[model samples]
Target: MKKIKLIFSFILVLLVAISCTVEGINEDTALLGTESSANLNKIFDISTDNSGKVTITPTADGAVSFKVEYGHGTTSSVTVQPGASTTHVYPEGKYTVKITATSISGATTEQTFPLDVVFRAPENLAVTLNKSIHNLKVKAKADYAKSYLVYFGDVPNEVGTPLATDGEVSHDYAVAGTYNVKVVALSGGVAKTEKTTATIIYNAYGLPITYELATQNYGIGGTFGGISTAVVANPFPTGLNTSATVWKYTKTTGAETWSGSYSPLDSPLDFATGNKIKLLLYATEVGKSLNVELEWAVGGTPANGVAVLKVANTVANSWQELVFDFSTIAAIPANAKFTQLVFRYDDSAKGSGEVIYIDNIRLTN
Candidate 1:
């Protein structure tokens, strides 16, 4: 009986000790489960090199690991441990970032953050425009610009043409007028730089007044005491003058003795190539004097003006070629530019309602 009691007492003591150990383990587990993650925060560092690079560091009170969802696209999530950071490159836009932190006790906390990434505007924008008649060429350059857009401003609701930094764009206008040209520089983001300028398109007359171009503005008119002057079809297009058009001069009855007609040229006469002006003339009567003169539109004097007079007409009622030698006046100032051409007929007598036809006015050696 004594041996049996001692064995029972030993078994009861072992049971009690095992029960206390199990209770102590349960209490420790409950305390750990109650301690949840808190105070989750993040730090973001953006690069200044315009590369759109961002470094992110996350922290929490009880976090041991993290799962980061960048929320920009289909990019895979990143797994980061405590005291570590991750980096990502993003375009210029806004995004929402999701962060999931896991605690040591298997508890998780999640939060969403709003992120905005903006780019800087381009700087020091410079644009170059060149015009040749009706054609225009454009080019542009700027700091931090990736591309360019050009608006020719000739059409209504025009779409911008794309251009590269090292490239040029060309446009041909249909009509002659002034147009506004705009160039925009882009930085691959919302920021941009723009510039605007004006360009003129017209057909400029230089030498050899032919009156053949339909689009050319000849600036033909009568000056002082003449009746009128105009470009008309060749009344007698044969022999020396077979051209389709001719300049007609009408000397009204009883007009002044110095009555004349004039035409303006786009630029001053250039006598370097030739020193003679040749034209075809038609008259109703013989022995009529004709004069051709050159005068500056502004600041002109007798010293700089030049004239050539034909003593009498050799042919009557027919086309005759006449040459006016300007070599005598070539010694005038080299910079003297004459912009106007004057024609006078029978300067010594009053007009008797005489009409004259002229054609093929050109410069020759």
Candidate 2:
């Protein structure tokens, strides 16, 4: 009975050992027989900031690791695991990319893809030019532009000034004239957009004659009639006429009653707004009459001349503001294009060489 029991136990142990060996062999075979890599694909994300940066993510059906050949003159390839991405920078051109995906069983599949790294030209380019006397300010904006270059056109062979996307550039001309201004927008590559404009640089004489800019041509006109006028330093820079310079009028003895001074404007005045003219005056006596006249240009007939008379009621030897309302005159047309401004003081009366100061001549509603 003891021998039978021992034999049964031995048989059971042998059967158990044989079953474990067979299972181990099957597991090893299964591990070595993994499916080959298939369905190799990739996604590319290219940057728009002109940095030439590209992110590549590779995908495959049974891939455990991937080797990427950027094909842009790179010596070594990039190795990435499944579901991983790699970044590379390339110049503007076309290239081919090679991807090799490997499975757990050491089987690999290779695929090739075409890549294009082209920079598009900038679009919707807008340029603005602001002129103040001889200085010009330039501003530009566009889409897909990395930088800007401005050519003021005043210099020969201009290298152009570098400007940022949200910045402005200014240039001062030595002499006033018309110039062609050019601006170029770059895309960090060979792609570019350009714009050209004819800009006028001059001292524009218009309303609100402040007499501040030294470049302005404040040419005096009209009959002096013994009244001499000059732009001099403000002798009485007090009250409302505290400016650096003022128009001085000296009515000498034996001066005619029509003694006046006039200045020609650059363009015709538009009376679309209300006809009101204001000027700062410093007189020697009160109750003095001042006349403001508007006349046609040299080519126009003198029949369209218009005048408005106002009396000074403020204290003497002090600055005072006087408003001349031409609207009160019904004979003057509303759409008159007046180009000359004439100033007369104490018309139809004799003068004893009294001095008067004038400043801040402007139009108001």
lDDT of each: 0.80, 0.83
Candidate 2 on 1-365: residue-level lDDT in tens? 99999999999999999999999999998877776888899999988877788999999998999999999987689999988899999888888999999988898899999999978788889999987667899999999898899999998989999989999999999987778999999887899999999877767566777777565666535557888888889998877777899888888888999888877777566566657888888987898878888877344533445445565647788898888887787766666567888888888688788888888988877
Model 2 error, position 167 (Å): 2.6
What tens digits encode model 1's per-residue C-alpha lDDT throughout 1-365? 99999999999999999999999999999998877679988887876545678888888998999888888886689989989999998888898888889999988999988888887787899999986657889999888787899999999999999999889999999987778899999887899899999776656555677777754555543477855678899989888888899888888898889888776766557665676788889998888878888766344633434445454679999999888877765455444456777788998888889999888788777
Q: Evaluated with TM-score, which candidate comes out highest? A: 2
In lDDT terms, how accurate is model 2?
0.83
